[model samples]
Target chain A: MNAAEIYKLSRLAIFWLSVTFGAVWVACWGVGVFIPSLITGKMPFLLQVDNPSTTVVFIADLLRSLTPILSLLVFIPINAMFMVLFERRSLALFTVRMGPNRHGFDGLAQTAADAVKLLFKEDITPRGADAFMFTLAPIIFFAPSIFGALPLLAAVTNNHDLFKVANLPTGIFYILAAASIPVVALVMAGWASNNKYSLVGGLRSAAQAISYEIPLVLSLVTMCLLAGTLDVVEIVEQQKGGILNWNILGGGALSGYDKLAPYWLNLVDTSFDTSAMFGQFYPVPWLSSIMAFVLVICTVLLFGLYLTGACAEINRIPFDLPEAESELVSGYNTEYSGIKFAIFFLAEFTNLFVVSSIATVMFLGGGDNPIPKWILDRLPLEPISNALGSLLSPLIKDLMFIDPATFWAAFWVIVKVYSIVFFAILVRGTLPRFRIDQLMDFGWKRLIPLALILFVVVVFARTWVVCHG
Target chain B: MEFVNVQELVSTGVAEALAFYFIAALAITLSIGVISDKNVIRAGFLLIGVFGGISGLFFLLQAQFIALAQVMIYAVGITLVVVIALMLTNPRLQNEEAEEEAIASSEPALLKFLDSIRNGFPGLVAWIAFVTVYMAIRSEHWEQSTQTIGEDNIAVIGRALTTDYSLPFEFASVLLLAALIGAIMLAKAEKVEDTDTPREGIESGSN
Candidate 1:
């Protein structure tokens, strides 16, 4: 909320996110890349073989295929734990209070301790509760976030071969469908809780998710329309040139600005016709230019719309009506006591992470460097960057263990994703929760019509302009 | 156009067989539950599982767009609405205790058996439908297409909807719009703000 709070959030995010990803990278490299390479005799020159036996080859193939699930299983818990602690610490900083500092170094292990306590606590089914459904709710709630986010790993990793299996032709649609499944779980949780407050919470969740989902989906649909693809990896690839090429910057409606600025500086260069270049940017002369300008404003509004709808979809602050703690008594999970409660809690944070990843991939340009190549070329940092690449090349060449491209992709993805996460935490610290009726009115009356108009405008204007770098 | 088989994603006939049998069995059980369950809300939840299983079957057929649409529209959207409608209209979610009491003082076992036999009417209807479908399958000549399914078949479907099937598509849109307006009118008609009559009890306090 304050500048100091934001600074603290950035510091906490950078430290904790690095620790989380650093551990994930090492573990994933060992299991997914290094060990498989060793088994197949593809790395560590001493282990190299012209032809591996069929059994060894089969084992390597299996290991490689299993990597995605294994890595996600490992990553989700740790990342959730980090996010919980980060949100707490950031919230505490905002509120000017100390948070969970006694557990470990600066309270880093607080969530770890909390998770363990939750696991060992008694998981209870209320006496009147439908036992089968009560047990199944959390599993349903938790499963989609994992499978739904699998395709995202491909987008975040620059479509690494091992992870690309998760990438479907209808990628974003698959994630969206998967994203919707958790609502059923939430309703099931509420009903099976055998409490009035819980049932109301569940019903509220169903209505809220259903209402907000349209705008949430439409906002992304607009981006997908602009980008002309549903595949997250393809969307990311299209946004690769720079920040201006990102969907947030009108999905390359203004890339002409970035492209033509250099032409402006070189106006004296009569070797190439400036008028033809100008014509190239403005296919319909003044109309194209005006539409391109309008497109930029619309895309920026779409980004805001996406963030708002995503917050509602994931039940973040200003929209967390389902589990509105003061009224609902922990909402649908009210009767859930121990490990089941932990699973619900974990999935909630994971959903937030997945939403941020979607925004990053669709709008902010997943894993793409924000700095334009034209700027980078003139920055006098080429040697240092080349040196850095060489430093990473050994891991790819000598060990055949890590693709440098994947490494950098993962790096930018972490930075972008965690930045969004911190922004969400900021929203949580700042905004008051909306009354349920207000939430409905905002979603139905305001967001939906705006989204539809944006979609139509983007569709019409997109034809007159070049989109995405 | 050819087999970009989803079964091959599992890579062997074993996974294919396993997935098919598992989903089919689940669909059967859940559909039965939807009919037989005493609680309407629980039955609605069971309907979701049934839709999920159907979506899984669609996924196996390599119609992923349809499969995902199945999940989004039917499994999540329709089922959620059904559940909400049940919640709003019939507040009693579970009638298990009353049903248990009714069963405790039920008719004789012979009468129960006779009723069970009578309940086989649905089975008889199902058989007739199945036979019709089986005969249709037997009469039709099936051919495998030579063109392989392109990776981006959604674009193909989109083109067909806009061009070849545009009339039907437009008609469908008109029908949907009609339904939307009708629903609004139905809802809005009840909002008669008459201040003529003052209610005298707690019922008036609710409004």
Candidate 2:
């Protein structure tokens, strides 16, 4: 076959190979999940209990737990592939032209196709490179991308639980701590490549990560304090009373009608006992609500900054200074090629997901169903249920197979994650790349101080509520 | 209050020993690399690795907070600043060849002195000093101290910073402010005259 034909053939082969690789990873995860009893001869981590039927329950729990992560591990690359396609379309739209219209399913698989092209492309290791460190950097950078997903796993319930890979007491802190390692790897990559632009990009990344990380940690700490626990599940539980109960606004009494009026007013007016009357009659304490309002606003502001910072950290568009093709000639990956380059690309996409997922969990009431409990209880059940009794009952039973609360909880989480991903894509489409100095100034001068102030305000509010209440 | 488990003690001992060995190895290797590496930038990178290894050792010791601080400040913070400085400033102009030549010229003398230290009078003095210190510390059977009141560390730390450490903190802040102001001044550009030079001597002096 000619060179062009051979190239096309290899492209197809690589595409199938990636799909198969993703499938195998998923299959391995599934088999490990479903046959845990057969493999381990003991209960899986999820199902371990004090009951006699623990092993049976454990296997079931194992499969249940495996589904989300298995899906996540498989779906991340696919999503990343979509993200690249979306970027292309977005760029096309920006330049006012139709882009990739001829590709698989109207440019849907364009990213996957690009991945195949990248995989088969000539892999070059630059001369005078530090081969070992360069090789190791991508692996180090990629490992944390998987581990970073750990804290995103929601707990089974609002109670103290062990639902993550490592049920670290300082769950959020552990995540922040582990997340910093990728910055090191990036710097290493830049340094090892022996390229000036790569070195500059790496330095910028390190500075950006350092500057934004302070706020990210402090803001999450504020959430943790509001939740009264560092556990992700507990944090979600703390937000259970819907959006009002979410710690972004404040928790408990400070959250709802109580914030509308002082204690004296509540005692004076019996009608103000219910939230509806309070909503109508008692005006929200403009000043106190300001505190909660500011907290939410700052949280969002910091989250936006974080999203931008993460783009920079991962060397993606707008913040893709580290790999700016026009200026830096691929930045930190200037000398990387083949599997090593693939790993860096994989890490970048995974990090995009990681940051978005984190933003979702932190600012967006993490896995909380917005449905108020009273509505669920007030649903008309008898006649509608009786008319289609058998079928509806079984269907309802099947629907409620997973606890309704848990189902809704996971639903909110998925929604939040997707929303954040959508935002990331929007950011990629809209913003232009920032200069290195501008990036640093934005991070340190603007973001870090704002995070510090927000953290202090949150602490003061918590203390004030506790002392007075 | 209670006897420690032998197994736990043994495991902890091994872990500590391993950690120490790794730290020592990393320190030695990096020091060697700093002295020997022809590329100055590569030496700086090696120095970063040394910092990271030390930070990892801190983590293994269960000092998670300290480990994070070390990574945040030293490994990433100071190292990056130093690397940036290395990149901005011409390394070749700043003792690059001189450093290599210095090492080469000093090699024989350094090796001879190291041999002497390894085998002679200083080694005897070091052994004696070590034994004396070990015996002195080991022989001291001080009474077990107990606190009458539980210390709230967070409050104590905050109070200490505001009180005893206040002066130092304030001084550090002032120093940082001054540095920032100086940087600003240095970065500010001045207009030039028609002669392709500054209107005043100020610009030339600043440059």
Candidate 3:
């Protein structure tokens, strides 16, 4: 209710974000580029590619492949810790309370402190527990989020050369498949604990995941149908023009209609070139206007369906019945202790980050600037940037501190993904948990049916819009 | 594509074969554990391990898409359901009865011998089946393709499902539909009970 308190919260949030991003950037560059270069310099045959021996080439290729993986390994834990801290701080802000500001620079290092405490705690195994499965559950839970985020790195970074090889042809499908593995881990953790509550929690998790996965997949399939490819990179490319071309606005379907209209109008004129006059004056707008309006409605519905399904899939608040503390005593992870518990904690936050990144890529147009080009071209910043570019060396310019496109693209992505994360945290603070029966009813009876209907409507309407508009 | 060196190919093949054997050994061991383990819930977990090992083998064969599908469908979906069912049944309840039976039968040596034979019957049949399958695999000649597996096997499989194999695809869908409807019928509560159930269930049950 207090506006000044909100402004102070935003300032603290921005400060913490910069510190987290600065650390992430340093870690990525050190592992992905610097360390590899240092190691490669010692292997002479690795550099001499003309007639290198087979083993040397193999080793070189293997090292090259490890670079992206090393960066990812370095990124996950650090980013997860940052996200946890960020969420806690934001939740505090929502309640008008100060949260965890004791450790380092307004509580920035609180997660690190918590990580240390978790490491020192006693790891326990319950009597009559399946010892092997009790140990393996957290690894299974954590490992998929690591590999799943790898494919999205390429799409999120606009296919940067360092991440280019990480892009698989069946990228989004692979991510989905990997993401599905964690439910098994939760069930394993629960059943292996030899506790009744844990067993119930695990059952709830599996049932929730299975029911919600249908709507989530349906929404993504609708977007893929509009984009015409399963490749995440290709899907982003299809939405590269501006905000209107984003998936939330029919995944460029309206723009596709726009392109088809000018040509078809020229054909229909059949006069001594009244087409030129029409192009300038814009006489009729019935079909195009109606189609655009319908497309917008479908897209809003699609985006809403995607957000709901994604929320349920990742076990976010209101949908987090599996781990509802008041009911199930921390649910499936009740018996997990020490570092194993930390891994579950880490993977949960990482899942939040992953889902937000997916939304940023699919609905908000991956790294594209929201501003259209005609307005951007009229801005006076270009002349100043040209002067600044002339003052810098090629290497410094390539380092991208001054490059306009990459800077703004990255700026927008950070803004979009973080905004989604903030929105999730806000929902956590505001919404109360749903009962299990209501949760099932909402997912199956409402969201899934809506998604299917939207998919069908978009399919027929897209063809009509493209061919006749 | 440029040709890979024969010597390099042989070395990589050796490495891949090593990985394949390791995965195969792990899978077989886990499958054995699935049957032999006294605790049914543990055996269910072992089944997941067996599936995971097979998925690893699929990865070694460079079938990435199939490997992922194997994990998603079998390891997560079917095996989790099995484990949950095993837990719900509380298999440990039968241990006391089994222990009492073992104590009672330990006295007569001939009766114990007959009991062992009865218990091992399924193993003997499984060993025989394994031998026959192994001999068949050893004797058959495989027609190895010269071309490498394509990069986009998912697309290839998708196209085939819609084109040449459309009838089979439709049949699979029909079978799934039947299963889904049957499951709904089995799980659905009676109409007379639905109203009472929701009131008790939502308001008082969970919390």
Count clashes in each candidate, considering only residues at least 3 apart in sequence or on different chains: 4, 0, 0
Q: Which fraction of the native contacts appears in each prediction?
A: 0.55, 0.12, 0.42
Per-residue lDDT of model 2, residues A1-469, tens digit only = 2454334433543453356445633453445343543434444344664343544544445554455456556756665665555555555555556667577755556767778888898877678778878887898788777765666654422221223443444556556756777887888888888888888767667766776666666666666666666556556555665555555455442455433434334434455446554443224545444555555565556555556656655666676776778888887888888778877887787777677666666656676666444443346766665676565555346333223444456556656665676566667777888887887787788877877787777676554332111
Candidate 2 residue runs with Cα over 4 Å from true position: A1-33, A39-79, A86-108, A154-162, A210-231, A250-254, A258-290, A293-296, A375-407, A448-469, B1-38, B93-207
Per-residue lDDT tens digits of candidate 1, residues A1-469? Answer: 4676556556666777777787777777777778877766654355555776666656666777777888888888989899999989888987788766678766768899999999999989998999999999999999999999999989999999888877898999999999999999999999998988899989999899999999989999899888888899999998887788889988888877777765677633546666687777768888888999889999999999999998988888989988999999888899998999999999999999999999999988899899976676578797996897788788778876667788888889888888898899889999999998899999999999999999999999988887763
Worst 10-residue lDDT window, candidate 3 chain A:
A276-285
Instruction: Report, for every candidate in turn, its global Cα lDDT versus the true structure.
Output: 0.86, 0.63, 0.78
Please provide, for model 1 over B24-132, each residue's C-alpha lDDT reduced to its tens digit, 9 standing for 90 to 100.
Answer: 9999999999999977888999999999999999988788899999999999998889888887774543566568548845879887787777878889898999999
TM-score-better candidate, 1 vs 2: 1
Q: How far is candidate 2 from the true structure (C-alpha RMSD, Å)?
A: 9.1
Best-matching candidate per TM-score = 1
Model 3: lDDT equals 0.78
Winning model by DockQ: 1
Q: After TM-score superposition, what is the CA distance of residue A372 in candidate 1 from its true location, in Å?
A: 1.5
Give the C-alpha miss distance for residue A188 in model 2, angstroms: 2.8
TM-score of chain A of 1: 0.94
Model 2, C-alpha of A230: deviation from truth (Å): 4.5
iRMS per model, in Å, is: 6.1, 9.3, 4.4
lDDT of 3 by residue, A88-171 (tens): 878887888888888976676788899999999999999988898899989989988888988887787777766777888877
DockQ of each: 0.38, 0.17, 0.31
